[model samples]
Target: MLTPKQARFVEEYLIDMNATRAAIRAGYSEKTANQQGPRLLEHAEIAAAIDAAKGARSERARIDALWVLQRLVFEAEADLADLFGDNGELLPVEAWPLIWRQGLVQGVEVLELFEGYGADRVHIGRLRKIKLDSRVKRIELIGKHIGVNAFRENVHHTGLDALGDRLERALKRNH
Candidate 1:
């Protein structure tokens, strides 16, 4: 049976995959979390708990890695030109879908514009635009999960190859 602290550590570890941070979050001493995290992961009970939790989460969500990749790839954005009105002003907040509103609206700023009157001022609106999250990065992450990479061809040698090369050089120098 896992202790309460160990159970908490396993839960936290699943959240971020950082053992030290998980230990700290699980109420371990900050000074010792760095060491405790790795040690807890090594415990068989904790490991099993984490694996079981991950399986349960996957079953509940009914989403696999492929589904996540597909969703990221298919995040269709609305036309940027349509976001503005005929007067070149941003449309009302309710005009776009929630996803569009979240991704396109970087920020809202209200500017006080003074007219000819001394105490009267009109509030002007400014909407900052931010680029949507890059599809390239999302694709890269998907490729990583799928064990595919365009740059893998560039890496020619395995770890053993480098060690062999070093040994050959040492032997040649000795001879």
Candidate 2:
């Protein structure tokens, strides 16, 4: 049971998950939307409604954590060799495996080669550069998904007591 405005806010929030923008779009005053948005989220009923909507959307899209992890793993393990032939020439897009073509390749740049300039220009050949998605980045994401801090550096912290002890030791040495 939501008021029309609240319902509208929920709908707009689903569009981008930007609560303040959603509040403004739902007819709230822009000046107060920054406060109003988070306050609305604090309501148990509103939170429940948002959760239900998210669950429904996830179900409709057939996407879950496992699905995302699988995709990340595929991208992380993508092989560059798959994009080239035994002769060491880059394969055409049609020849590339479907998974690599769809998920690994980020973009392609083509440079048309020509001889001469102006009207005398003759088409020679083309140079293609294929940009692949960052495998290291994908691996890092997979590590994060599985709760492995593979890419994170260990941070060591010294307590105040430890610092005090070190200072006393230094003072004794000086004395």
Candidate 3:
């Protein structure tokens, strides 16, 4: 559960407002919104609650929420799917981007997803760490577009758990 102010900020941000805008709407200084916005979003419980709300969200609202969530994580837009199936499947193959900018091709749908997301160049500094090839990552994206089809019917909508699992496994394999 978020504080009233925090909750209001999240609610406003979910509607397509940036942190600065949301902060202003939530009755905070626009400058403070930048500092406070990331802190509020960093709360694990708050994130979990937001994810729960987004899971059952109407298709239209869900898409909107996806835009906000992508901006929150990657600080940029993403190509995440819009319509989720009743069986809890992502109808759209597009997933979110990871700000990866590289010259090598990998099986990473997040690259193309970012391109589709209309992510801004405002924060290219932090996003520069990702290494996505100039050429589309065809093989990586061929079957992993959604990156969460691994779930059965009881699947979670945002697929964070699945993604975390994959990331953890990859990290273990790497080191």
Candidate that scores best on TM-score: 2
1-175: candidate 1 lDDT, tens digit per residue:
9989898998899899999999999999999988889999999989999989998888899887778766655543345666678998867768756656655455555554544555665445444554555656666766676778763557555699889999999999999
Better of 1 and 3 by TM-score: 1
Q: All candidates: CA RMSD in angstroms? A: 5.2, 7.0, 20.4
| lDDT (C-alpha, whole model) for all candidates | 0.76, 0.89, 0.53
Ranking of predictions according to TM-score: 2, 1, 3
Model 2 local distance difference test score? 0.89
Q: In candidate 3, what are the lDDT values of residues 1-175, reduced to their tens digit?
A: 6779878777777677476677678888776777876766677876776666566465545566456444334422222332335675534324322333221323333322233334563423212122333322333333244454443246457988999999999999999
Off by over 4 Å in 1: 25-30, 58-63, 76-90, 108-131, 145-148, 151-175
Candidates ranked, most accurate by lDDT first? 2, 1, 3
What is the alpha-carbon lDDT of model 3 when measured against the actual structure? 0.53
Per-residue lDDT for 30 in model 3? Answer: 74
At residue 128, candidate 1 shows an lDDT of: 52
| Candidate 2 lDDT by residue in tens digits, 22-64 | 9999999999999999998887888889999998999999998
**Candidate 2 deviant stretches above 4 angstroms:** 115-125, 152-175
User: Which residue pairs show collisions in model 2?
Assistant: none
